[model samples]
Target: MPEFSRLEPHVVAEILRICETMLDEFDQSYKHSFRLTDVHGFGDFDSAQQLAADYRRKAAGTPESARERMQQFIDALTQLRD
Candidate 1:
């Protein structure tokens, strides 16, 4: 596999944090039946769908990058293990 170097660890952490927050909001919104009383205009299905898609894209990208990092880490660890 190709080496992974574009994303720094701190940037990945930040992205993961944002994705977690968005996922939590999406979960809460669904549980409450998309109640507008608590979230104003953000309770609509379309808004939620868009946010979900955006979050998914970011999350997938982050995971792919992280996977590369993790593979590299594993390879390095394996060298020690052997």
Candidate 2:
């Protein structure tokens, strides 16, 4: 069974919302990073993608990044409740 199957409907909705919001934010940030690289003449598509891939690898192994993501979810939930 899925973990969300055990969760209340509203809680599940909030979780999904949080995930969508985070993904949107990540997309925006990614675009901004590329824009910055272009503006500074520092990176190209291959380099940018490589950097992102490297970060993904690092983040996957980093507990701190996981905590940061959890904190982002908690903060979004708090904002929604307030």
lDDT value for candidate 2? 0.57
**lDDT values of the candidates?**
0.51, 0.57
Each prediction's number of clashing residue pairs: 0, 0
Best by TM-score: 2
What local lDDT score does residue 58 receive in model 2, on the 0 to 100 scale?
Answer: 42
Summed over model 1, clashes come to 0
lDDT (tens digit, per residue) of candidate 1 on 1-82: 7776587888878876765665565455434532322323345699786776554454334545333344444555444333
TM-score of each: 0.35, 0.40
Which runs in model 1 stand beyond 4 Å of their true positions? 1-5, 34-82
TM for candidate 2 is: 0.40
| List of clashing residue pairs for candidate 1 | none
Q: What are the per-residue Cα lDDT tens digits for candidate 2 across 1-82?
A: 6655476899978887876777666555544443332223336788877877666544443545443454465566556545
lDDT of 2 at 21: 75
**Model 2, residue 51: displacement in angstroms?**
17
